[model samples]
Target: MANLDLTLKDMMAVDGAVGAAVVDYDSGMALGHLGGSKALDLQVAAAGNTEVVRAKIRTMEQLRIKEDIEDILISLSTQYHVIRPVSGRKGKGLFLYLALDRGRANLALARHRLRDIEENIEV
Candidate 1:
């Protein structure tokens, strides 16, 4: 199994991956991050996205929808933003954020790869 740091490193190696971070939605903080540029700061992105996550969860709660978030995909002209919430008791309220170059990334493959990365990444 890949450890957190190692798995994050592996994710950064994906063809289009530009930046990645493991974030805690409850706290709006990134526990770990890698490969960010001036235009995209992983920590800042993580913090901002935490609100998105929280808002979604709250909305679901209010709607009485009993479900888990698999992942949230935000597509931009130049990039693909992926938010994958970790499962299992040990990983509650945490997610993996990956930003990839749209031209270089294969969305399906990247989603599948992120699932694998999630399985192997230890808290």
Candidate 2:
């Protein structure tokens, strides 16, 4: 299984990847991050997405949906934010956050790649 840094690095290899991070939704903090610009701070992006994860979880609980979240997609005018919660027992309370250029990314492929990366990630 891959470690946090290696997983983040592999995520960047995806087409149109701008940044990637392994974050703790509980603390809204990044465990590791890679490939970010001055205009886009990976840490800040990671922390912000923590709220997105929490909000969705809360909503699901309130609605009594007995389902797990596969991923959350936030599409912006110029970018796509993909938040994937870790499902492994060792990875509990953590997630992988990815940012991509909307114009350059193939959303379907990116999601597939991210899922594969997550499966191999070691907490």
Candidate 3:
């Protein structure tokens, strides 16, 4: 299994990856982060996305949808923000967030790779 550092490094290898972070949605805190420029602060993004995840979970509960979320994709004009909640036993309440350049990223492949990274993460 990969540790947090290795997992984040792997995420950077994805095409068009601008930044990546592992966050705890419960506390809205990032456990680790890599990449990101002055304009894209990974820490702030992680906290903001925690609200997104919590809202979605509340909605699902209210609607009685028992399925788990695969990933949450927020596509912008220039960027794609992918929020993937880690499903492993050790990773409950944690998520992996990746930001990609919309024009250069292959969304499908990035999702697939993120899944792989999630599975292998040791947390």
Model 1: how far is 53 from its true place, Å?
0.6
Poorest stretch of ten by lDDT in candidate 3: 85-94
In terms of TM-score, how similar is model 3 to the real structure? 0.98
The CA lDDT at 91 in model 3 is 92
- Candidate 3, residue 46: the lDDT equals 94
> What does candidate 2 score on TM?
0.97
**Between the candidate structures 2 and 3, which one is better when assessed by lDDT?**
3
Residues 1-123, candidate 1, lDDT per residue (tens digit)? 676798789889878999999999999999999999999999899999998898888999999999988899999999999999988666777899999999999999999999888877778
| Model 1 lDDT, full chain set | 0.90
lDDT of each: 0.90, 0.93, 0.97
lDDT string, candidate 3, 33-100, tens digits:
99999999999999999999999999999999999899999999999999999988989999999999
Ranking of all predicted structures according to TM-score, beginning with the best and ending with the worst:
3, 2, 1
Off-target runs (Cα >4 Å) in candidate 1 are none
Give the number of the best model, judged by TM-score: 3
